[model samples]
Target chain A: MNTLFVKAPAITLRFVLLLLISTVAMVADHRYRVLEMPRGWLLTVMQPIQFVADWPAQRWHGWTEVVAARSHLLQENKALLEINQQLATEHQQFAKLQAENRRLNELLQSIATSSLPTRYRLARIVQVSLDPHTLQVQINLGSQADVFLGQPVISSAGVFGQVVHLSRYSAQVLLITDSSHALPVIDQRSGQRAIARGDGPSGLLRLPFLAAHADIREGDLLLSSGLGKVFPAGYPVATVRSVSTPVGEKFAEVVAVPVADPGKVQEVLLLWPDRAVQTIEEPVTDDLVDDQADDGDHE
Target chain B: MNDVANWRDGWLILTTLLAALIIDSMVLPQFLGSFRPDVLAVIVIYWSLMAPQRVGVGVAWVAGLLVDVSSSGLIGLHAMVLSMQAYITLMLYQQIRMLPRFQQTLFVLILMVLGKLLAMAVLGMTGRLPTIEFWFSLPASVVFWPLIYALVQRWRKRALLPS
Candidate 1:
């Protein structure tokens, strides 16, 4: 018998004690959030580990970019240039319409509800959640970059998610596809408001609360309603894929596919909604919208 | 162990644990994501069996805490599961040490499956119970165990050789 090993009784005692402590911690973290401060400090310590883990993947991406065919790059550039020109043409009309809407809002004295100008910062995805059940990702931005809880995250395609946990150098984003996530969205064609809840790893959103007789249909585009103040209004979210109304059920089973493909997105934009419109930052001019789009491209 | 040997041993163990954490955090392809093994648990179980006096329930608990923080799950979920796993491994290490390699792999599968079940239970408590595909990790970890065991054994032999 090895005398060096801990006694069985001692092992049992330690196990029970540690189990109790961890249980307390789980409750504190989940219900009370008392562990947030310490979690932040631990995440700061973990930054180096995360960086080392991400290094190989980042290098592989860089290598692929360097080795990409010239023809492929040229094709991508051509397509992007075409898209840019089309957007520029649309912005001319959009700028004029925006000015007219602002003037009309000012005349009506109901200017509080308009979707204000937004500021954006680019971020790279550093780490995705290890748990298959939890739909969250950690980005390379945090409190150090003025990122706060509930900041909206968007890809060039559409709404992606929002920041949920913050450390000094990194933040965790709860993807809009997590079962626990829900967004308030408006049907662009019908102007009907509904809540879009995530359907876990299936990468679909569910409109569970919509009544059976609701005026929703397949192919309807959903946009952020801006009712919750988390996502900005007018940004595309998802498109309804299927709607089935059972004969006896009160709510229709509507499923929509998110516009932003979470699997393919490597970069995302963190948005800062301009809360105070104290001074209309830029005068109404055709160049204003062009400048805004250019700034977004720079990010 | 002398001070120098002890210091070197500590570094070896820490390096293995850090490697496990790094692997745990790496993003797997979507098709493979659900099948990724619980690498940290496997490492903790190995250490608990090989060096029970040095890496027991306490070490397991700390490792689990790191996993919880890294995975951003409820803070204590993995901690509770891993500590429990370590405690059981410590108790059975001597008996299991006598088993052949194939049986040992089977034992690891059982241990890891139990840990997965416990994790699923905790997630269920929060109403986030995963789909049946969550069990896919069992076969993966089972396949990974022999490689890790061989590597760690070789590492231990080199670093902790007697004077």
Candidate 2:
């Protein structure tokens, strides 16, 4: 059993060599495109593993479908139809507002009219990264359907995350609740601007620089300010959950729960909105274009 | 089974590792996310001890690489961590095997936590401070070691050997 290769020091040698290689790879990945090709291929190769991993969950989901009662499906259908009817009712008023806004833009001959018509596609969550530190999810849509890096992804209810990486058949979205993620948000109640950063997957956002006496309150809705030009403006990002100021602390430790539950989103909305939402083309613009000021997000 | 001289168990190990990878990446209910076992880590630990020559540092490195890729994480991140884990297991296999089952579990708890902390350190150095869920995974994985050990043993008896 005592092979020469199995000598005690051999294990140390292998471990050190492999660790050195891995560390170099990680640093290279973080700093440059040095490893993108290999990384992409590895993910592609591992696709089947992920697919097979998904099989049990997918099968379990199918089982639920098989046992679903006819009455239950019927009830679900009816409820969905009713919701559609309500949305359609809201659509009529939105089209009128859109026309009026167009007219106003024409009269003013402003850059707001330069905003391009936007389109969006639906994608399903295929995999969720199990790493507790990095909050990311893999969606079924990829470069095939015009998915791009930095494109904004939203749930039907509100803004969720941004697409970070894309393969041919899948993409990864970094959730706003990740610690490294920061977003520009405006409080709907007071129109106060603050930068909301994720504290981690407790599903809450922290406003780091807001003054202790800022006119913010619990239950205030925070919307994308669009200052970052990544997430479109006026989508609900989070709702204020708490506000606190420790003794002598300069900024209020304002806490908020994300309006879009990263875990609960079955399908994501990939938006193709223009860079500025209005793209005033002004270098120093602070306000998100007010052309869609009503901000109902009809589409 | 004991009398059999055959050592052709490659397929059995591969299937278990594949299953482990799948289970690790599968999406679970939100409440269960915290309790999600590090299936791949546990499996690597089990195999490096059960059959060190077959599934040593190199096998563990590949397993870690697969996890990093499949999870869509930074490349080589898990490869380094899992390789370290397997190395430690190899170093202590003899002593660990001699311990009682409960003590074996206790040792596993320490090893799992240490590996997790090392991975966490790598993330922190890369400027990503993971959520509490990441921190919670150590305990979660430690709790799953006995199950992994038993499963590997069962596979050994049921598939690897002929009765």
Best by lDDT: 1
Error of 1 at A6 (Å): 1.5
**lDDT for each residue of candidate 1 in A1-299, tens digit (9 for 90 to 100):** 34666679999999999999998998787655568678877888888888888888899899999999999999999999999999999988987898998888889999455665467899999854455667888899988997876778999999999876788999888888887678889999998889898888789999988899899999999998877667778889999999999889999999999999987999999987776233335321111111232211000
Candidate 1 wrong stretches, greater than 4 Å: A1-3, A127-129, A276-299, B1-3
Q: How big is the RMSD of model 2?
A: 6.5
lDDT of 2 by residue, A147-213 (tens): 7666788999898988766666677777888765778999999999998887765778899889888
Query: What TM-score does structure 1 among the candidates reach?
Result: 0.89
DockQ of 1: 0.67
Report, for every candidate in turn, its global Cα lDDT versus the true structure.
0.82, 0.76
Estimate the TM-score of every prediction: 0.89, 0.80
Count the clashes in each prediction: 0, 1
Poorly placed runs, candidate 2 (over 4 Å): A1-11, A30-37, A106-109, A112-117, A127-129, A187-191, A211-220, A241-253, A274-299, B1-7, B91-110, B126-163
With a 3 Å backbone cut-off (N, CA, C), the pairs that clash in candidate 1 are: none
Residue A120 alpha-carbon offset, candidate 1, angstroms: 0.5
